[model samples]
Target: MTRDANRPLRICMISYRSNPHCGGQGVYVRNLARALTDLGHHVEVVAGPPDPLLDSAAKLTMLDCLDLYNAENPFRTPTVRELKNPINLLEWLSISTMGYPEPETFGYRAYSHLKNRVHEFDIIHDNQSLSYGLWALSRLVPTVATIHHPITRDRQIAVRSVRSFWKKVKHLRWYSFIGMQKRVVRRLPKFITVSEFSKTDIHAEFDVPAERFHVVPNGINTELFYPLPHIEREPNRLIVTNSADQPLKGLYYLLQAVHAISKQREIRLTVIGTPKEGGGIEKLVKKLDLGHIIDFTGRVSNEEFREHYAKASIAVVPSVYEGFGLPVGEAMASGIPVISTTGGALPEVAGDAAMMVPPENPEALAEAICELLDNPEKAKELGEAGYKRVQEQFTWKNAAEQTVAAYREAIRDHRKI
Candidate 1:
């Protein structure tokens, strides 16, 4: 049956795991689902463990998973009853052997659940789960997989970050799922990504032609991340959103800059994430005597996020690579001046609204931070520009419309076959 272009489409948005508190994938799922539903399209979110918070207008279908990798209890063994299902058994075996199996296993689960109900929805939208089951689904119904960016970059950076031979081997083994993703993505025809940089990078890494990819930029939720006019911005106070110990986040460089600046003047740095106890970040803080200057707010609510941004003089995105650079957009939407690294798609998101610095360079970061702090007028100017940029360029309504176009294209492609 062909889709009616004038009528509202029924969409099955599938995500293997979605935790609404953090991570770009979960954030993407929540906002995009709401946006599509707001456009009068029927959106039903089918997700796994650690539920995603969605708008009341959107329906949610929860899927069961062992959730062995939950941060609270990492790698917990499942009971015999839980493992009775072959799919669960496979997931356990894969993780026990140091391989990430969520994509492949979740694909099987999604396929099992949706096989008989294929006609219930007009299309299936897979959020970066390029599993073999997604390929199977495309054969039955139109499928659009959003490859945020190639996971190959993560694997490469992770493998190189470690020193020991055994550590490098472990990283490689853990990311073995990339092999399946690469094969699965190459077979699929329709794709959606967040940026031009991601589209080109995915094409080179996944070997999917650029023409097959649709670039639909993610929208910043202004209601959740707008400037708090009542709160007074602090001076010589800096804030950054990052996972403290992740090598790809470039937090080490930001800390180095903070330490250097603290020696010359009194400055406070608030990190919107926690560091592992006895981790490298904790040790560095002790060695540099920066414990007094730096503060880490583990996980924060939306209100806390705005409060943090409202109190800060500047917001920094020190990531080495980001497919869409949500932090940059969020900071901009909050009406804060941003200093971002020239990594992956950061420049595409910042777009002259932010001060661009070279990635992994502490000196450049330090200079830029000092420049913004020293000139409040300049910082204010940038902040206004960024807010205007977000209003004019980024919105969930726009993203939802572009995504529908991509869905129609996928349907057309599937019908031709």
Candidate 2:
């Protein structure tokens, strides 16, 4: 059956595991589902453990899977009953061997669940879960996969960050799912991605032609991220949203810059993520005597996060690479002056509104933050520019419209075949 362009489409969004606090993927699933439903689409998110939080407009169907990597229990063993299933056995073995088995297992579960209900939805949209099961589903339903960016690039960077031979082996093993992803990617015809940079990077890394990618940028939550003009912005308070120990986040360089600045002036840094105990960030903080000047808020509520940004003088996106820089857009939407590294798609998101710093350069970050702090007028100007840019360019409504167009196209193509 062909889709009616004028009518709302039924969409099944598949996310293997979505934890709002864990990363941007969860945020993407939650917000996009809400946006799509608001557009009058029948949206159902079929997700795994740490299931995403969604708007009341969208229906959520939670798929049970052994959540071995839950923060409370990392690599915990499953019960014999849970392991009775072949899929669960694979998950257990993969995690025991240091491989992330969620994607593969999630695919099996999602496919089994959705396979019988294929005719119930107009299309199946896979969110970065490029598994063989998705390929199987595509043969039955019009499948569109959004590869945020090639996981191979992430694996390469992760391996490069480690030095030990055994540790390198561990990194390689952990990211072994990339091999499965590559094969699954080749089989899908329709694709959606967040940015132009991601479209090109994903094509190059995954060898999927750029022509197949529909570039629908992710939107910033304007309601949650807008500037609070009533609140006085702190001159010495700098904030960054980063997963402290991740090598790709470039937090080490930011910490270095913070340490250097603290020596000359009484500046404080608020990290939105926790530093692993005795990890790289914690060690550097103690070594630089910056423990007194720094604070990690760990996981914060939306209200607290907005309040944190409202109190900051500068918001930094120190990531070395991003599929789409959520922090850049969020900071801009919050009306904060942003200093971002020209890594991956960051420049695409920041545009000319942000001070572009070279990735991994602490000196440049330090100088830029200091310059903005010293000239409040310049910082204010940039903040206003960023906010205006986001209003004009990045909104969830626009993204949802584009996504629906892509879905319609996929349905049309499926009918042709």
Candidate 3:
């Protein structure tokens, strides 16, 4: 497919799991597709498993795969109908017995379906499904994959933190997909990442040249995330958005900080994602007698999420690492003062607009939260500055423009080959 400077480009975005509630990948797929469509391009998102909440402007093609690990029921037995397909049954058996991530296997299913209609799109953009199938598809189309960040970091952190030696072994076994991802990522023609921090990490981890990577910042939907005029902000209330049960999110640290803060001052915590009813976080909440002070609103809709941001006096992002902390940008866009840890690309995204602390330091987190809570004027000033920062720096329009340029560059480079 040749890029014509005057004509609109047809683009297909592929993702293995695009559940908005799952994590950043779904959010990225939805917002980027909308932004590309807004730019007068034809955008089709082909995804698997959980449904993606996409913009109406973009066309959505559902490519269902055996979603063996849905969050609602992490590991449930497939029905007879789901097991009727021999490939699906084999994939399920492999995952059940060996503990390997299935996104690549599923991506193969999606690729096979899309490859038959390869001529339908000018470019194929993948959302972190760095599978062998993607390499196969790249030969037939101008393909570019977005590697959010190196999954190796996630595996290392998870393994090192496991309390039991057996559990650590299991962690390594589960994350064995990293081997496949590393090979797939290195062989890709071009890569798009959300931040320079991630780009550097990707190059180091996958041994890809710096020239093969493009840094395109992810966007926040300011329209949906903006502050609510009617909602009253709560005093001394703190909010953090994460898959709270996930250790990599650093929710445990935030919980420790909240416990420390509650001892000195009256504070309330509202967690956006759900925690296991009898999990570590729930145990901590009980141990600290934080039932009255802490509340978890599990898997809220977009409007409700915005209301939580609006009601909170401040937002805290306690991630151990992020490719680009979407919550930080989302909080900033919602006109909320942010207190983030200096983990990964957070400082790059927050800049001077947010108060930064070191990750896993409950004391530092408590101090920062206290400082903001004690001084309303400072908090309000920080909130306004953050809003302006997001407005100027991280918008979907900017991301799409940079991405389109990268696509054009990839096409030019491919032609020379």
Quote the lDDT for 281 in model 3: 79
The weakest ten consecutive residues by lDDT in model 2 span 1-10
Clashes of 2: 0
Q: Higher-lDDT candidate among 1 and 2?
A: 1
lDDT of 2 at 367: 95
Candidate ranking under TM-score, highest first, comes to 2, 1, 3
Model 2 CA lDDT for position 195? 85
Model 2 residue pairs with clashes: none
In the range 131-157, model 2's lDDT, one tens digit per residue, is 988999999999898888888877887
Clashing pairs for predicted structure model 3, backbone only: none
* Candidate 2 Cα deviation (angstroms), residue 111: 0.5
lDDT of candidate 1 over 1-417, digit per residue (tens): 444776899999999988787778998999999999999999998888778989648899988889997888989989999999999999999899888899899898898889888898889999988988888988899999998888898888878887999989988998898999999998888899999999999999988888998999999999899999899998888999885576778888899999889878879999998888998788888889998988899999889989999999999998888899889999999999999999999998899999999988999999999998999898998999999999999898999999999998888778888
Per-residue lDDT over 350-401 for candidate 3, one digit per residue giving the tens place of the 0 to 100 score: 9999999998789999999999998999998999999999999999999999
Measured against the true structure, the TM-scores of the candidates, in listed sequence, are: 0.97, 0.97, 0.95
- Give the range where candidate 3 is weakest over 10 consecutive residues by summed lDDT: 1-10
